[model samples]
Target chain A: MSTRGQTHLWVVQRVTAMILAVAVLVHLVTIIGAVRGGLSAAEILGRTRGNGAWFAFYAVFALSAGLHGAIGLRNMAAETIGLRGRGADIAWLAIGLVTAGFGIRAAYGLFA
Target chain B: MAEPASLKVSVWRGGEQGDFARYEVPARANQTVLDVVTHIQRELDPSLAYRFACRVGMCGSCAMTVNGRARWTCRTHVRKVVGADGELELRPLANLPVIRDLAADLAPFFDKWQRAQGRFQPKDAPDGAVPEDFVVVPPASKARREADAGIECIGCAVCYASCDVVAWNPDYLGPAALNRAWTLVNDVRDGAHGDRLDAVAGDAGCHSCHSTQSCTERCPKNLDPSSAIAGLKRRLFWDTLLGRR
Candidate 1:
């Protein structure tokens, strides 16, 4: 890979990390607020469902988590175990799919 | 006169497949790790092999694992390394091919240096004019200051041996080479900036370094390869985004 590509990835990874920092914090705070408001799952779903705004927020969270996690796993393989090959690439894709699948599905379950 | 005593030293005795052979060398007031190895080779075992050039620290040849850390044995004092048992354990430099006892093949270390473009490529003159005799860069310039931080690395494998990334990733260009590349990249006279950046940008290059600071913590010359690697990463980040490369 070109240095430019690698550098771009570095930027993407860090930027996603920052997004995740904010996203996770917002997610936590939202959950705490919901609990403090004594909102049931039915009530939470009633509030979140058909809401484009909540859907958009969760989508960003899922996207950031996927990008951050996939990049991190790629880095871990390269740096920790020295795994760099077609196998590693395929593995990264698989991990990204699995992680994003769960995150996006839950977001859809609540917001869609 | 004082009581005559000996230092309990454990010297590694063979190639990669070997164990530490114990020796009771005559302990002196100002003994160094190199002195112990030299004494063991000369007096006890004629077959013991280790490399040393300058008895002083100028030559980086005598680097070995004293106790557990990579050190230039020529400059490392015995008093500094001896445990409570007054024992010293000597082994070949870690993460290298040990040709024999205490003598590690540094070819990989040097090979990575070339891979990192650790050399000076002169810049051409502007407007098709002849190249000047010299390029005047200020001593206090940011580039010069950054370059100066790592320019003093003596090609010693101490940093290479200390790097955990190298231990995990054989293809990763180790710290000494990357540090050299960093100095060259910051050099105002150097022209192969893009090529140098590209060389160290891939999976097995600068980005692979986990910033463990092992190289910085153990550098015999006190150079911060961790910082140099960071500079390389930051430069690559901007050059990549700005299309400067």
Candidate 2:
């Protein structure tokens, strides 16, 4: 990859890390609150379904995670196992796409 | 005469996958870890192998894991590293392939130095006469001072061994290499700032570092390679944005 592209990846990783930190905290707190209140999965689904704000938050979180994790894995593979070149890049791109697809699909399920 | 105080030292033996062999060596007052290893080799076993030069702290040789932490054995006093029981565990540096006992294969470690373009590439010919001959570098400048703080790295691989990024990613250029690149980048006479940034800006370069500061902590010289890597990151970001790299 070009030097600029690498810098962009590093920046994206930092940004995603920040997003994940907040998302994980919020998710954990919500889970704790629901469990303490004896909320059922059905009840949670009823409130979350068609909730635009929740859907948007989760979508952003998932996309960030997908991008961050894919890039990280690509770097790990290249450095640790000596895997590089176009093949590694393509594999990472595919992984990112799949993760983002699943994330978006789940978000849509909640929203639709 | 009272029997000499013998400390049971366990030194790693063999290749990448090996077991620690126990050796009984006489412990002396103010003896360094390197001294202990030397004694074991000289007195007990000629087969035990390790690497050391200068027997001081200059060559960056003599690095080994003492009590679960990477250290320059020549300078690391056993009292400081050993636990209350006076036991010492010596092994090869982490995150690198062990060539033999305490000697690791430094090919990958040094190769990354080349990848980072750590050498100074001067723009002008050595014999060429310049319009303004002297390049004045003021020691008082912040950049020069920042460069000076980490100028003493001995290529010991201590920082590299301590770095978690290197453990996670073997292709990572490592702390010492990136630190060298940072110094070269700040050099006023060096004309390859753009190329150096290009070399170190990538996935296996300074970008791989997670800012864990393990390099800073385990550095025997007390140099902050973490700061150097951070400087490279910032410089690379600016260079990339400005189309300089």
Candidate 3:
């Protein structure tokens, strides 16, 4: 890949990190408060189900996590494992797509 | 008078694959590491190979791995680097291939500087016409100040030897080269901003810097290559966004 493409990935990684920061904080605080307030798994699902706002928020969270984690892993693989070049790029993209796929599916389950 | 103290110094011998040859040298007050090496080569073993010049830390030509850290041997005192057991270990700088005992092949280091476009390209005078007016740049200008911040680098590979990124990625342009490129990038009168920016962008470029500040921490000149690399990153990011790069 060109350096420009790599730069774009670098920028995207930072952007996703920012999104994950906010998302993780909100997620932990809200979920911890709910559990401490005596909400069960089914009760949490009841609150999230049919909620469009919850679906969008969780979907965005999933996407950011996927991109952020994959990019970090890609760098680690390159630096540590010496996995580089086109093969590594394709592998990382697959990892990101799979991770985001599962996360968005779970978010859809909650919404539906 | 009490007997003079002697230090057990282990110096690396041979090229590529070699072992540390130990020597007992008389310790003197305010003795530099280079002095110890010199003593070994002169009195102990005439065959020991090493590289040095200036001997005053200005040239950075006498850099070597002293007691596990890359340093200017001419400036590093024996007292500062001796282990608790009063032993010293010297070797060639890390990352670069060793040419002999303490002399590392600096071709790759300098080649990366070229790869990073660490040279000034003057704006061409059209058709054999020389401009009469002088290009007077203010010393206090922002670009000049930024350039000044990184201009003191003496092409020493201390930052390169200390960088984990360079150790991990061979193709990665090490800190010294990238820092040199940063100085050139900020040269307002230089005509190669676009080319230099492109040279320093990408995975093996400034983006590969993990911001560990190892370069900043190990720099003997107190110059901040990490900050310079961050400047390059910022410049590249903005350029990409503005469609300039």
Candidate 4:
């Protein structure tokens, strides 16, 4: 990869990592609290469905996770299997697209 | 007085496909790993091929893989590295072509250093200014401090030998080279900042480091190549943002 491309990918990976740190904490806390509070699925869905703020939060979470996982997957293949060049680039991009597709769909289903 | 038992030393005796040649050498109190190698070469087998200069730790030529770790053999005392089994193992540095029994060819390592532009380029001395006119950098300055961090490298391939990145990717510049480049990047008197940053920012450069800190762990000089690589990353981004590169 070119210098600029590598630098941008590095920055994106770090940024997504920071985002995931907070997202993961919020997600774990919410789920644990809901279970402890005896909130049923219907009751939980009532608050999440049609909620703009919740949709936006989950959207950001999904996108950040998708981007972060793809970059990490790309690095794993490169370091472990010596994968590089255009093929590896395309593979990571495809992984990112599919991951974001599913994640966003799930997030939107629950809230949008 | 009771005589101490001899150390069972196993030295690698050939190229990549070589077998371990065992020998029983009389141990001494201050016997170093290099001293054992020297004894094996001088007394046991005159045909043993190894490289060393300035038997002290100043010269980096005496480095070898001792007991599964890269180290400067001269500074490594047998007492410190001797296993409970009263044995020692020695081999050529890993991740390099073995030119002989204990000396891995350093050409590839040096080539990577050159690839990373690990050299000082004077901006103020185009015509080679006199020593009195040299750029006198203060010791407390950031540039000087950063440069000092990486300046003690003796070109020992211990860090290179210990790095898994180099083992995984042959094209990677390894830690020592990138660390040297990071020093050059921080040098205020050095004019080739953009070129140095460009040389060390891509797949084969600082970005390739996984920050596993294997280099920092195995470095005999106690230098941190991982931190240097991080510095390079930060500096490279700043340079790009400032339109310096």
| Best-performing candidate as measured by DockQ | 3
Flag regions of model 1 displaced more than 4 Å.
A1-7, A78-82, B1-4, B125-130
- What does candidate 2's lDDT look like per residue over B1-245, in tens digits? 22247777888999987998998777787889999998888888888889998988999988888878889999987777765555789999998899899888888888888988888776564343452566789998877887788789999999988987777776778999999999988887777777788788877788878888999998989999999999988876666556665
Clashing pairs in 2: A79-B171
Per-prediction DockQ, in order? 0.63, 0.38, 0.76, 0.59
**What's the lDDT for residue B77 in model 3?**
84
Cand. 4 TM to true fold:
0.92
* Ranked candidates (lDDT, high to low): 3, 4, 1, 2
Q: Which stretches of candidate 2 lie over 4 Å from their true place?
A: A2-4, A15-88, A91-112, B1-4, B126-132
Q: Give lDDT tens digits, candidate 1, residues B30-85.
A: 88889989999898888998998987777688899999899999888888778766
lDDT of 4 by residue, A11-81 (tens): 77877888999999999998887888587979788879999888888888988888889988887888888
Q: Which candidate's lDDT is highest?
A: 3
Interface RMSD of each: 2.1, 3.1, 0.9, 1.9
| Model 3 regions more than 4 Å off | B1-4, B124-132
lDDT string for model 3 (B171-190, tens) is 99989999999988887667
* Model 2 / residue B68 / CA error / Å: 2.1
Worst 10 residues of 1 chain A by lDDT: A1-10
TM-score of chain B of each: 0.94, 0.92, 0.94, 0.93
Return the candidate ranking by DockQ, descending: 3, 1, 4, 2
lDDT for B26 (candidate 1): 88
**Docking level for model 2:** acceptable
Candidate 3's TM-score reads 0.94
Preferred candidate (TM-score higher): 2 or 4: 4
